[model samples]
Target: MKTSTELALSLNPAKPRCTQPRRWLAAIAVLSVSWPVLVWADCVDTRKATAAEVEFHGRAMAALVAALPPVPVGGKLQNKDSVTTLGQQCRGVTGDFNLEATRFYELNFRKAIVSVAINVRQLRTDAAGLSESYGVASPNRSAALRVNNVVWTVSGSDSPLRQALVDAMDRTRLQGWVDKPLPSVAESEALASQAVPAAVAVPATGAPASNASTVQTAPQPAVAPEPLREAVDAVNKLRGLFGR
Candidate 1:
């Protein structure tokens, strides 16, 4: 007697035998398309920030706070009037913005000059409330504050991120801040003139002492490094969850 497979094939020879391979190909195609999404999802995993990143954030936050108009003596920072005023001031500097549930503003500070996402949230509720608000207090708290978005690519003075960074650098008055505006042509020429040293007259071997022209070398000024890119797309992705 023939084996079951052989008997079935003999009975229905017209049936396609390539179905298994076709199914496998379809599965592989799907997996190829889905692989990137899976990788991006994994980007949400909590990761430690580098020292430079932490320091940069501290400075950036200070710059932002400094840019805000001072709160009136009795006014709270989170109050409606204060929020509105702060939002206006921030927008004047940074362009359109999203005020996040009266807590912090959601800003897309990603540009060629700076890259950051200001969506990290803090746990302000009790443990029981936190658990109810977000399941599993430990992981939820970390997840709420994780940075996961890819940095956006933007440039020019029209960019809110670039403008915000420039304003920040201006406020700090630090020399060689990466986000500082490039000097205008006239300004650069003036600086070049100032940098160049005066040439002195020198004596030649057989001639009187005052006759020869001497060359003077001028050193080039150090250029600031370009702003660095970092993970900054996470805020746009999780706006709903974080708006609270």
Candidate 2:
């Protein structure tokens, strides 16, 4: 005797359950066609950097810039003594910069040290010889200084958004900076104006300057130093030796 349920099934002949998977796949395919990629956030706006974010950029740049020091000096590339001196100098400078970076991370991410290092390196690398060694071969010292200055300015800003805006030039398009003028201090100020929140004051002069209620510009500590002048002159003489 056929039960009522069996009789209904026989009349209707229910569709196979396997078809559900196919239906799901079809829906997913439609969605994929409509939206091919997943997007977590839009780049529509900019804001201030958290303490952690500032530390991250500051430490990362410090590590990178530190690795660049002990710029290959003296022509005797084939001499063991010269190479040994270079190694020793590199080790010393790397350790010093790494210590500064660690302190910057532990502290409030103050950028003065990083900016000083970048500034001195900018001066050192102005000679084509030294610049070529770093693979940044730019003849224009002013241009290189401008690019370095902008990086130091924005990365240390209170706004992570402003940093991202300049990262396109400092990080991705660095090679393009060899012949072109990269972003300037004024340009970074413009970016900050747009990206910084209304509640937070933006620095008018740039980083190493207070972004507090009243902006104050401090003279760069790295400039006008007798040691820097001597170091730069010495490296320039080395370049003459190598005809760079």
Candidate 3:
């Protein structure tokens, strides 16, 4: 007699390949969908994330900012729409600023700059020679530099969050991120390291004073006496007579 298992197999109709792939393949496809894709652990609630979470987000934002196109010389807003769009896209991307933060940042995230920070950020440029002086058909200057308005906003404000934002700007050279092409971290660090000193104060009474003590007057060349002048003229007259 045929084994009970063999008899059962023979009685059961085989499943068609067209209807389904091998069991392993079907299992894999099912598993792939069920498995959660890897993402930032704190992407859901950054405020609760530790310092590591903040750093992760900062880096993500930096990379996002770096990938942006560079600002042309003299500064222009070429990607105003792109920025708004990117803002929209970033809401879905983890580690970057939340685009949704726009709605909630001012509402609940003021203690930190998560939402309003990048939202308030806008590309700014101070283009020179744009007037009639530049001529009727001049090409856009290549010297355009794009800077983050957020930096200036924080700079002027007394917000406790200013330093944190400033630190991000320095590390990422984010001030130029959107308008300028990406630069190496080393390049940015070097630029930030060479900080410009504060301007010297001008006198309240008037214009600033020059460092006169450092100035040096050129020495005057030796001059012949008045008698020497007359003597030279007389010599010239004597030479004329000799020629005669």
Cα RMSD for candidates in order: 34.1, 31.5, 21.8
Global CA lDDT computed for model 3: 0.36
Candidates ranked by lDDT: 3, 2, 1
Off by over 4 Å in 2: 1-113, 116-170, 173-176, 194-244
RMSD of 3: 21.8
- Model 2 / residue 162 / CA error / Å: 18
lDDT tens digits, residue span 57-133, model 3 = 34334443433323212223312322222221122233233311111011112222222123222332332211011
The estimated TM-scores of all candidates read: 0.20, 0.18, 0.23
Clashing pairs in 2: none
Return the candidate ranking by TM-score, descending: 3, 1, 2
Off by over 4 Å in 1: 1-45, 73-178, 181-244
TM-score of structure candidate 3: 0.23
RMSD of 1: 34.1
**Candidate that scores best on lDDT:** 3
Tens digits of per-residue lDDT for model 1, 33-80: 999778556344334454433443344333323333232222233233
For model 2, state the Cα shift of residue 148 in Å: 10
TM-score of candidate 2 to 2 decimals = 0.18
* Winning model by TM-score: 3
